[model samples]
Target: MAVTCCSVCAIQQLVSPYSAELSNGMQMAFLFALFTSAFCREAAKECRRRKKEYIKCLESRVAVLEVQNKKLIEELETLKDICSSKTD
Candidate 1:
């Protein structure tokens, strides 16, 4: 009976530490997941900010191109008048 008691105590001791280690591992995994989620959220916010800036830049470029096209059209009209006068 004494030997059985000693074996049971030894088994309990071993199992207790294994359970504690498993709990600690789960805690560490939870923390890692929390931090990774935060990092991804911040990355997504930055990408959105950059995309907004890119859209604004593209809008400005389009406006400038429209002005340039108008100027080209005006210059073409003037050239056409000059050519017609020369022909006359």
Candidate 2:
């Protein structure tokens, strides 16, 4: 009857209005709504956790690619110098 969370309180208010008429049906519906709310809360937390891990993986890959790109650029410059010396 006394719900602390604003969201849950709102749900209870919505359900309470119909409680007298619905009786057992209202109780079942309220329980189902609560279960769904808790499940969604947990699912959202899990999604955030997975998103953070994916971002970390992408950052690591970007760092590795940057290092490899620098090495390739240096090698290209070295080859250019060698070619110019042979031509001279």
Candidate 3:
């Protein structure tokens, strides 16, 4: 990776500063390096994006579970009341 980075930097210098034109292959390598670097920078943001999505999903699930639990508790209390009245 370091070697590739160094080579890319060298190629960039050659193309930009030294007024030396690169061959088609070298130009392609340089463009690939630039794109790879850009993607690497965006990769961290992508990770954060996925994390946020996962957290949102978890929170929504939790909310749904909480509501379901409340409904179940209410049903259980109603059953208890009915059972007590039957005994009376």
Give the alpha-carbon lDDT of every model. Answer: 0.75, 0.83, 0.79
Higher-TM-score candidate among 1 and 3? 1
Residue runs of model 2 more than 4 Å from their true location after superposition: 1-22
| Candidate 2 lDDT by residue in tens digits, 1-88 | 3345985666677778778878787677876788688778878999999999999999999999999999999999999999999999
Each candidate: RMSD: 15.7, 5.4, 7.3
Q: How many steric clashes does model 2 contain?
A: 0
Q: What value of lDDT does candidate 1 attain over all alpha carbons?
A: 0.75
lDDT of 2 at 66: 100
Best by lDDT: 2
Top TM-score prediction, candidate number: 2
Winner on lDDT between 1 and 3 is 3
Model 2's alpha-carbon lDDT is: 0.83
lDDT of 1 by residue, 1-88 (tens): 1235755465556456556556767755654565566668878999999999999999999999999999999999999999999999
lDDT of 3 at 87: 100
Model 2: what TM-score? 0.74
